[model samples]
Target: MTSPRRWTLRTENTGYTVRLSPDGPWAELDAWGPLGVEDGPSALDWSRRTHFITPADAAPAEYLPYGLRPFAGADLVASRPGEERGVWWDFEAVEEAAGSLRLAFADDVIGLRAVLCYSTVPGTDVILRWTELTCTGDRELRLERIDSAGVTVPVSGPARLTYLTGQWSQEFQHTQLDLPRGTFTMGSQQAVPGHAYAPWLAVQDGASEAAYGVALEWSGNWHMTAEAEPGGAVRVRAGRVPHEGAVFLAPGETLTTPRLACAFSPDGLDGLSRVWHRYERHLAGERLRRPRKVLYNSWEATGFDVDAAGQLELAKVAADIGAELFVVDDGWFPGRADDTGGLGDWYPDPAAFPQGFGRFVEEVRALGLDFGLWVEPEAVSPNSRLYAEHPEWVYRIDGRPARLVRNQLLLDLGRTDVQDFVIATLDRLLTEHAVSYLKWDMNRPPTERGRPGADHADHLDLDAQHVAGYLRVLDHLRAAHPHVTVEGCAGGGGRIEHATLARTDVVWPSDNTAPLDRLSIQYGFLHAHAPHVMSSWVTDAPGVFDPRPRSLAFRFVNAMCGVLGIGADLRAWTGEQRAEAARWIARYKDVRDVVHHADVRLLGTPADPTFGVQYDDPAAGRTVVAALSTGRLDGAPLVPGRPERLRLRGLDPRARYHDAESGSTYSGAHLLHYGLPFAWSADHDADLVVLTRQ
Candidate 1:
């Protein structure tokens, strides 16, 4: 038998092929989808050249040896110890394992080795890629521009790119652009990921269907580029951002880049998103088995005026409405009446909680709710006790002043004392109180990221070290207090990545809980993260900045799509409103399991007059669809022209499903082919449809 020219890595129900050209230039991704080839190898060609076009206007004119090639993104970009020319690597070896493949390449002249690694989860289409570079020569290597991995897809007709961009309070706004054969890029060098661009990008075949996507798993500064080559082929490159400084490696030293996950789907962008959800659950391991509590956070209700009596009143109402966890956010800490002070002081305000957290915890527990506290361990207000005692603890350049963001300076996690302080403080809090959950908030990025006692030569990369230190603190807390769950919130959605997700049980996508605006925010968030980890809250009407007065049902239905939380001030609600909220909470509990473990599908975009999400768990034989209608402004009573029917997806066509609400049974074939009629009145209407395999 002849050796296969193309090798296939078969995943769950998808196949990805790596083909080597007969001319022996480079290995290219020939195909990636449900079928290995859409038509034939000739139709989906992979015979493109590996070299760059000479003096191209879009790229460097000098033809940087390791830069933009016609077929694939550069895997490695580095020069010798004292040279400016990038090393030219030739493919050497390929190895295959259980669910992984490793490709090794080498630069003979410079004696540098580069290895490209690819791995996939057992039952998902996501292919993870990363790079390892090492010097085999007898000299040191100065490295710059090292990307984890890159892949290219050939387009047939009109193509478009979909991505997300937003600010602090308005994060994860879904946006798209027509692919007109140019380079599109997003990156962050602010020491942490930015609110403007999420580390994810998708390329769709015009109709916003049949898509391919890539998401970087790094938490530190990172960059992702999607360049549309002239001939309808788009290449994507992503990895850690080399913004701090160039890396130097002595002979025999090796550096590994962060993992970049790529997936393809024939069913559209929603299908592609489902694969990511599955992959994340697989990584979540035991955490997936634990049921997420119906949390009630008191941040919006009692911002800085948190007193024991106020929290107790909220906890009683929260428990009455089925909240299992009650979190006191921000104001509980000493001197923390406002954002400008008391960030580093992690203890309860002496006057507010005269007896400390003991009585408050007992009261919340007495109301059948678990207690939680908010802490900004990585940030310090200059006026606080922690900063006043150790001013050198904050990140700062030798003589320059420490820059403040949100009236706080980022603690130099690189220092042993600072790290110790964070860990010890958290350990004491968890040990002292009946705190079942922690709202870990890092409100700002590192500024003047330089340490005082450390030498510049060795401690120049303080930002990266700070990230590691932050992760270390979480690891320690998890080990020390296994029962405590941490919710990662970096000024609302700023610190999102696979690494951070791995440590925390949940993430706050944004502080803005206005139901109308959140529809779009949640749409973009779920594209890259699992719904179980995305924290969605239902607060009061006429949200913070948005003037839309959404019905309580609309807010509950929207928040139910994720790990549901109630941030509304139940204390002020009428008896009828409280009863209604209780019923919604009960309904959420009925399908919480399915919501947490199911494969989510984005039913329609926020741009559509009707927006919603569908959760389907084939194995569990459960399906839940939550749809919200954008009603017209004219105070019309009835839903304008009737509600649009929702077409069910991910159903077994031959099986039967029974709708609980209508008490009707329908064939899976009919439900999948046709859509179920939704009942609603006026606008801003919301409904939760539940079905079971029967």
Candidate 2:
């Protein structure tokens, strides 16, 4: 027989290979990671393990197929008459281009065609995969489960599943579980890529230092399922959640799944994480190089009591402490005394800003700081003038009572008028004000999500479309105002995802500024996202929510790990505290480039409350490690036997390094193995160690 077709895709230190048999139509993952073979496994031999009657060579194991043959986990599921109500795509053609591969499969029986796309970058060990399905038949078809990508992992022993789980103030807490014999599924149906669980998953065998993972690039409700087949093999599939209903496709109609990013690592979880960070950085592109200026937000400091004079005082102190951007949040708008009013009214509140924002902007600029404003265009307050003027603009049924959260109702952005108003208002704001930044906050979830004319039952689809419309406005606004930077905040961090991050410059990790609580929150966050785009603020030491007072140094060090911002009421600070903060701000500037551009490694797991993260910039020849003690550092140690030393990684082992904090010199080997002693001298004490290669 002719040699079976084989292809190998290599990325840095990893490789992915797929094998196809001339006699069979299925595409099997021959090898992944370091074990990937360059030459063909052309024999197509399975006699060594086969027990039942062997299937046709054309129908080998499928990585992405419907209930055709004995597929483990189908990537595409469809129904048609006379065919067991499933899709069976026959292999047609395969094309390879620069750093990309395309495979075409068609099921003439149902007139459906499937095209799978795969691509990889130069320096990262990740493969981006997504599928496009086209209907060529004259009849309609129902698509039940269409996944972005599907891959089978070869397992020799027990495998563990690692995923993220958290809620509200806390997000991306990593959770691991041993694979069971049945299907394990996780996703978000909350209309937003929620805080409860991140859209990333990995199946790893630490024993072999082998792992396979995938992250979906979708923002709305999505699903991922890992099925452990009867054998030791496991199949993973991911895509948008079809909870609304099976999507109906008419003749000549086409549908595309969200891109699913997959990565393989032979160096365990840390390597896999580093690969993901690099991939995200590559995706971020120019944003990574753009300076993430230290910003000062007047939310925790002033709340709804915003005014020009008070803000000017805050802006002076903020600029004094090295803040580059000054943002007035919430109360700047007309009728916006609090969350209950002044949402849709995008204009400045004439009373609070008697001189208008132009004066405030000019004063802020005079202090050498840029200006920003907070706006929630996707929502309307029931008490606002905009609501009274355009009641039908908000999401509601003709007779049903409008559901309110945080005294606000969600605007149906799916409507063209809403999208137009948002674009025009934001464009005007950028055109008129010298505003350099915008804090876009979505404080509430969608309720009564139906359009004015659409049926209530179709609201789920409307929710999905609303998110698209929101993206459209952002796209247009960004295109029109390229100089303006936007920060995404859904209350806090609720709207963080690949889809939203594509347009916004930064994301608010959480609303909770409590340093102690943020330790875990930030740790969970970096598991899937990068640090440069994560907006962290050093609010008041005693935090608005968690009243546990922490040292200024502790708060500063903790917040310094990400895009540093200060939200505290600086006007109330003592002279000594202000001096101390100035020093820390200077220190953060000293390391901001390294922290933002380096490869991030989350060093500790959630079970270990005393976790830390390391940032390494090989080109800059420096590394920064920030370790935090989440529990009480005052009365008693929470973990009585917690390790006092933190062994750093991603360092050049042969080089000599200088510890700037201790003014001590040590070999890289010593720092890697012996580690620096974490002197948790006080309650909630945080430690930051900067190592410079000498």
- TM per candidate comes to 0.92, 0.91
lDDT of 2 by residue, 231-302 (tens): 566778788875455676778989888888888877677777777777777767776778888899998899
RMSD of each: 3.3, 3.6
Error of 1 at 521 (Å): 0.9
lDDT of 2: 0.77
Which pairs clash in model 1? 631-683, 631-684, 638-682, 639-682
Q: Which candidate has the top score in TM-score? A: 1
lDDT of each: 0.78, 0.77
Cα shift from native, residue 53, model 1 (Å): 2.4
Residue-level lDDT of model 1, residues 341-458, one tens digit each, is 9888888777998776698789789999989988888888899888889988888778787777888898888677889999999989998889999999877877677777667554
Q: Kindly give the number of clashing pairs for every candidate.
A: 4, 8
Clashes of 2: 8
Candidate 2 Cα deviation (angstroms), residue 576: 1.2
lDDT at 391, model 2: 84
